[model samples]
Target chain A: MNASSLPRWIDIGLLPVLNLIAALTVAGVIIAIIGENPFVAMGVMIKGAFVYDGALGYTLFYTTNFIFTGLAVAVAFHAMLFNIGGEGQAMIGGLGVGLVVLFLDSVLPPLLVVILAVPAAAAFGAVWGVIPGWLQARRGSHIVITTIMFNFIASSIMVWLLAGMLMAPGQMSPETRSFADGINLPLVYEVLQMAGFSVSRSPLNLSFVIALLACFGVWYLIWRTKLGYIIRATGHSERATIYAGHDPAKIIMLVMAISGALAGMMSLNEILGVQQRVILNFTSGYGFTGIAVALMGRNHPIGIVLASLLFGALYQGGAELDFEFQTITREMVLMIQGLIILFSGALAYLFMPAVVRIYSSLRKPTGSG
Target chain B: MADLWLQFVLTIDATLRVATPLILCAMAGLFSERSGIIDISLEGKMLMSAFAAASMAALTGSPLLGLAGGILVSVALSLIHGFACVTHKGNQVISGLAINILASGLTVTLGIALFAQGGQTPFLNKSERFTDIVLPFAEQAEHVPVLGTIYKEIISGHNLLVWVALFSVIVTGYVVFRTTFGLRLRAVGEKPEAVDSAGGSVSGLRFQAVIIAGVLCGIAGTYLSTAHGAGFIREMAAGKGYIALAALIFGKWRPVPALLACLMFGFMEALAARLQGVEIPVIGNISTDLILVLPYFLTVILLAGFIGKASPPRSIGVPYIKER
Candidate 1:
């Protein structure tokens, strides 16, 4: 069989693993050059990411943010659009959450505040996501360029609002005051205790469950629904989509709005669940990392979930590496992440020939038997 | 009236300095895009070259050597990009973004390892940097009106690199518009199949264009480290590479128009610098953050065709696959 006709298992599962191994090998070489044993560093990373107490919680906490952003990108990718504005979307979404909490935290019940905050965050992010989408659909602007520009605009707007309009009274830092406790999401550890299991107290909250639900929701939307069929059809070919009597422009706007809404959900995790306050730069490159997540996961919900978890491990484990080794700093971790992005994205088909060769050879023997 | 004139002169001077890297980078992008490659790796090349230049200037105390080092590093990155996009048929934008991410991480890692200053090199001595070259008779000519002020304030005291940037515009214009290679380059971007049928190698032309981009980006990076600033800092290129790309689009991917766009952006930057903390009527204290966002905001607006259509090359982002 040819490379393109490879089995789905190898295509989705084995190839990404091979690429991940290649990426890690290069990272290992760099680690060796930096005077650290790559094996030891790998062991430390794995342990820090999963085996240590409270590590899994933090990993999942970060995973929650990636899930939102990754799904956002995945949805947009299905419509042949690159939504690089997730960083900005998440920021504005946080603003939405913060606004809702700040206004109703003292007056409304906890459940009621959450009920209002979720939709508010999605609406704000959708607004941010749609402008670039609209420009691309109606005015012929490139989505990538416009989204990138909006990221900067979103950041500058946030800085101004945080430092000037939203600064807590009597505070010098550029962050709003924490909302009342009623608005805060319950921690996972508390829920686990309620279920009679002891667990480490960590920042993992209700948002993690919501993120899992979103994964299921996205899976259903993409494969089991007509809208997803139209989105995927548009991604395959705009001409065919137009021939099908669907307005490509409307589909683009719809896809981008959905992507933006998913990105906005990140604020519920980052702001209401953990920080309990809106702050500057809290998105912290999660939006960009989402692009990598979508790429590695092959722009599928299941793959995105797995890729998000892997990246979450890298993030938490990379931080552990920084804390443990002088030679392995945060930048080294970023180098590894970048290498993974390079391998998975630009060199996506680089190893396909080799994989196809091996698979064909294996199949020849099995078929004869 | 004279005070306002002096302010204008000074702003124009600052605009040139700020616009130097931007103009160089936009021209670099023009070469790559004009030859059918979407070069978003401009930022990566500039950052890596800036690191090389600063490190060399700091180590050896020769700004010229530093300049050479920067160019070499940038050229290497350009070759890598060509290998991925031209030879391997990879996605151009993904490759460019990967180069940027790789450059960002590698530079900081190397800087921390080499200098031990948390990703910053030691400060360069004034003797090791590209110092200003005051024009002949500039001091004496300052007595004359308008032209004298322009000569003295804007053109007389810029470093050698600034003059080189200005000269590059005419040179790039000639190379892209007048030369046979220029014809082949434009042909390759628009219709690679036609160029290939006409006995030209599409990949070869594209690779050459990428190399030119690398060299120009190197010069831009060198100027940033060795002339505009004292030494290398993490992310010293800032967002100038993307801004350069925006300027390229704003200028509709041409050399002369791109240069004009860069100057306009540079003027906006200089204006922002001057206007910080200065209050204006009706708006009441126009914040620096808003000004900082102006270039990107304008790019989006311009991109939306509020000004006019800014079309890219026909087959710019597509990888040219040869049939056997």
Candidate 2:
């Protein structure tokens, strides 16, 4: 019945599992409160997401973006930094690719341009991210505030640039020129057909692989490398790390730059892989949704993948909710996501009693059981 | 000399109008942040208020009633933020963003359902709207030479909300630094543990701050919908609430400096709006949306550079957990 009688995995994993339950319970209640049958609505949501032919691609399309953003968020989380500017960074990165896709195509081959554009977008996004990181490192400014401000700046610049400079000529709408064909990421036309399950769509592309690679790379960078050790240590105790001969400021900047680059990659993947060009609303809220994914995944790579898939399903399913049940607004899905984050964060603590009881009953099979 | 004077005068007028909403938001932020709430949802709260104000004004044909309704709704939302962050001790950032998303969808859906105008309220004519008001002496003083010109250019005419915004700043200054409630609010923010230890309720202070923020946001929202523009458009609050938050932080969380920060931001916004329609030689033509980006861009750069080492309220964004 004491500490020595506990199962180790139960102790560590119980919190995350309980958080999932709590989130689901809350989301279910919310669905009910909104006058939808929680069971039917949820079932419909799943079917719309996975049952349809092209649905998986649609789900993966959003998941691709969420995973990259979630990774970016997770990278910063490991370093104990908050990069609220991810949205801004992603946006500017989108702009970079949009520009290259639209303007530089005349000079470069499409495949080459696509290859180069992703990195270019990441670079621009990283630059956007680094300013706040630099401020936080050098001047002791709060990244939360500075990055938050930077998001506004980045979005504003996007609006201005898209509405003014990059706007397609002779178009009355306030949008940029249609991306030239060369820079677009390719569909899984061959791969999907061979798999016997792939249905081609407008936004289907190869960025899903790139996103998985990014997740793997982030995991390796944070867990495998010497730099990762220093970053993690500094995040835990900057003063102690400084005492042990590390520059805390340098670590913060590096963490932020890497995070920004990852966020930039998310934007690039979405624009290149899915949208095929940047639009004003190109992201479909992937940047913000990543925050939820990161938290729900507990900032782990595998966890991020799982959480991103769930979020991607919700996003894809939300559209179908409109077609099936006109009353179930897209807002309902967002509400569920928010509830999931809220309850999940708190559920870790809530599950401790049940976990302790289970641990005790297993070790001592007599009265305690 | 005359041309320069003209430019300066024009700039000042633009500064005042743009700054008016910002000042209210900054003051609103001042109360909440001063009491330890990192309010990221100011944008959403203001958005809701603006939506409410515009729609109400259109339906009622009464600006005064619209203003009241706006304040009431925003304050309620602010209370929701307070309850979640301060009482339930939930993650403030998440809760704030939740409120934003909630507001965004709610407003858009309601806009479509009620008005049938695709997230915009029907435009109200001058009689039905909150029109600009010219000060009495200022109007008469137009007969005087340079003084009349200066007064006319600088401060003669503006929406009545502009005056209310300026007055609200003074009120906030007096209430924040000079009053018992204000002291409690600051104490809660800077050192919640201390306040809680000293028999002061941290929750109470937080609730007060949120309500104050909500009221200010409500007024600011009304200004956006009724006073400044003829109708309410979706997401019209745009990024101004965040801009005001930046101004508050840049001003080092002090009332006076916060007002100054708001003014500077307002000037940038106004200038951008003016320049949006203005022709440029080198670029030939520039869209107003690009110009709209100027204030936000400037805020980011300035926050990073000039706002040297600004520290937030010590207990900000962290829910207060009583020591076990």
TM-score of each predicted structure versus truth: 0.97, 0.86
TM match of model 2 to true structure: 0.86
lDDT of 2 by residue, A286-358 (tens): 7777778887787888989999999889988877887887456676676666556555542334556677776
The candidates' DockQ values read 0.74, 0.29
To one decimal place, how large is model 2's interface RMSD in Å? 3.6
Docking class of 1: medium
Poorest lDDT segment (10 consecutive residues) of candidate 1 chain A: A360-369
Q: After superposition, how far is residue B241 of candidate 1 from its true place, in Å?
A: 0.7
Reproduced native contacts, each prediction: 0.67, 0.28
Candidate number of the best lDDT: 1
In model 1, how well does chain A match by TM-score?
Answer: 0.96
- Per-residue lDDT for B100-191 in model 1, tens only? 88888888888877888888888998999999999998998899999999999998999999989888889999999999999999999999
Q: Candidate 2, after superposition: displacement of residue A124 in Å?
A: 2.9
Q: How high is the lDDT of residue B183 in model 1?
A: 94
